[model samples]
Target: MVNHKKRRDLTTRSVLIVNFNNDLPELEKALIPLNWECASACDLKQSLRIIEQKNISVAIVIIQAGNELQVLNVVSKLQHTTPDVKWLAITTQYPIPSPYLKKKLATLFIDYYHTPIDWGLFSNSLGHLWGMSKLQIESKKEVREPTLPQELVGCSEPITNLKKDLKKVAIVDNPLLISGETGTGKGLCAQLIHAQSAREKEPFVIVNCGALPSSLIHSELFGHEKGAYTGAERQYIGRIERANNGTLFLDEIGDLPLDLQVNLLNFLDDSSIERLGGNCPIKVNCRIIFASHIDLENAVAEGAFREDLFHRLNILRIHVPSLRDYREDIEMLAQKFLARFAQDDSNLRFTNSALQAMLQYDWPGNVRELKNRVLRAIVMAEQGKITERDLGLKLTNNNMPKATPNRLRTEIDTETLLEALKRNNHNVSAASRQLNISRTTFYRLVKKCNIQW
Candidate 1:
């Protein structure tokens, strides 16, 4: 037993006990001294419900002498739904019964214990696992924070409109079609939608329909059975089945072969799939998000894509704006990209000529092209500054847009300032850097525009 004094010293933590041997009372008592709040479930259904209802960080599976296979299925199902939680298994039999079962157990559990429980060792491992889980969450937040819709590095009207559409599509559970030019961040938009939806905690699986060959695409998306084909050896789960109860993002969906499109349409219609060699239907409850760079409507008219399938996905649609559509955001995007790529030189900035060249040029490749150019410039720039030559852009007198008057410029400046502030979470310093202005100048403008943050 753990020391009773430790219970009052630490904050209470939640743990799910997957009890299969009717040992719930004994396990609950054993966990008392560690100050754990327990939620016990006897089967897979109950366990899933409790995990969804409560924020469970850890789970303890009690495996019986003859119930290894039953417990394995339960653990595997739970892992599919919630992969973040750390699992620990306890069994009455030592060395387990079968070698295969023992091997599978080793792969699934963080730690396992035999009967005559060593409370001291178990308590230490539990605490360490909890600390590790917290660190992993904090790390993900640091990486994902910058890419969240609100912080998406643009504040122009087109970008603002795109953000609004993303929010609207996120709250609803519908098949979404994201249309945009190649490299316009359509896949990123799909990820943002999944991150903001009710299925945020579930897996977000991506399938590049264009990357795989036509002959192998069908088996790859739907999976194949062992010995079902020439290369068959073991039963393989398909992408759709793996994404059960989560979000599935099919990138470059327009490239999917005409024959495969009908199969995809059938899956979308019934939310079920049949493995290549399997007979029974496997029901998958996952959100489908499709992204395409080409014009699907044109493809339909040209007989390359099915019109019926297009309509199925076109129910909830979002169009990612091209770089030229939001030209005002170029400077900010370039500066951000420079800051990200030029990590060692925080003082590095684009010269005025470079900014003018970027403004004058029509971006044929959109945001992705802009990012690559900035990265290349960082490698070629001199004396902590980037020039037009470094960005491989030459300015022509005829390409520049006509200059605006003082009144119009002032209105544009005010609107840009407000959007920058909102996008940067009202952090004046961050917003100032985004606009390539000094903190003092940003504050003066805020006061001049009568903007309160």
Candidate 2:
């Protein structure tokens, strides 16, 4: 092993080229904005030494298929050793023994070029490599053990206090388990903790544990060796490695498979995971923050999830309030979504009746549905204004069971729409138009109302 430790201080676009000949002159003409340095020695060992000494961000390999096995061996080592390093391969001839090798190299390397490489394309490739490097560096800087200010929005008591809790938790680098109802802004709360924590400078990596499959969840979370499993096409570092010194958010953590729960539990306690096939543990220095709509306490009690894992993750907790609990904030949040969708695009306005009707409505889907409905109404409403009928709720005969009427009006949404329509006139279009609903839906309301348009 050659020692280039002294040269690690240099900041340049170091290119480690493993070629038979020292082709310094040919590589000189290609213009890639950053400082360029190259090593043309075919010995990968020597090239790696130069890379370490020079802090090379990119490597261009020049190889030919003299023997089938040699080519595969060379490519394999390059892929593993230079996992994060971008690679550009230059082959002197075409139709190299196997087309599979070519395809494999294309997938693994940044770019591949045939004999007589185009200088323009080569430069452009290097340019893209350089831009990605910049983004990675910048992104990593934002998330590494950062101390971010509070990022949670909303001034309601729940939101205001949630920010305070997030701030307190941000200082501690431990597991934070957040529990909330669906659509209660748990994701935003997790983001706020990442933004405020010491790891704020590194990166915020979110993994939906429920979305991962039983077969893939292990590899996806812990990564795998090249031949670890059948579809192990390539060795890839998992998200935990990507957030090396930042925050790793495991969303819907209650849904993590039972086996994975064990792995995650150990990882949380020890900050380590062995890649699927590899024996060596990869040390990850990241804060663990998890969120779930379901109560993990209940999951543990039901024996569907691990009790120890839940205990490990619940070091800090933040409970996000459902939209119904913050009923006073409905109109405020609705108007925010309305303005967001209608910005410089549509001429949709909410009539006082429509606004009052919205304030009285029950948004089961929370902020997300409210946003979608507002955007939909803006696109579908032919009239300039949104009325009670446009809202699609009838205002008469409050038959639906009320969920805490102090915050919401006791009447059903359909009844509210009907009352708004009746007040406007039997005109279905006018009623639906005022309701901020589509014309077709308005026609349906006409039939439902037994009123002639």
Global lDDT for candidate 1? 0.78
Across 252-366, the per-residue lDDT of candidate 2 in tens digits comes to: 7876878888888889878898898899988999988898866678778979789888878777788887776676677777677676556544567878766666666676546
Candidate 1's error at 40, in angstroms? 63
Give the lowest summed-lDDT range of ten residues in model 1: 141-150
TM-score of each: 0.57, 0.55
lDDT of each: 0.78, 0.66
lDDT of model 2 at position 320: 83
lDDT score at residue 275, model 2, on the 0-100 scale = 91
Candidate with top TM-score is: 1
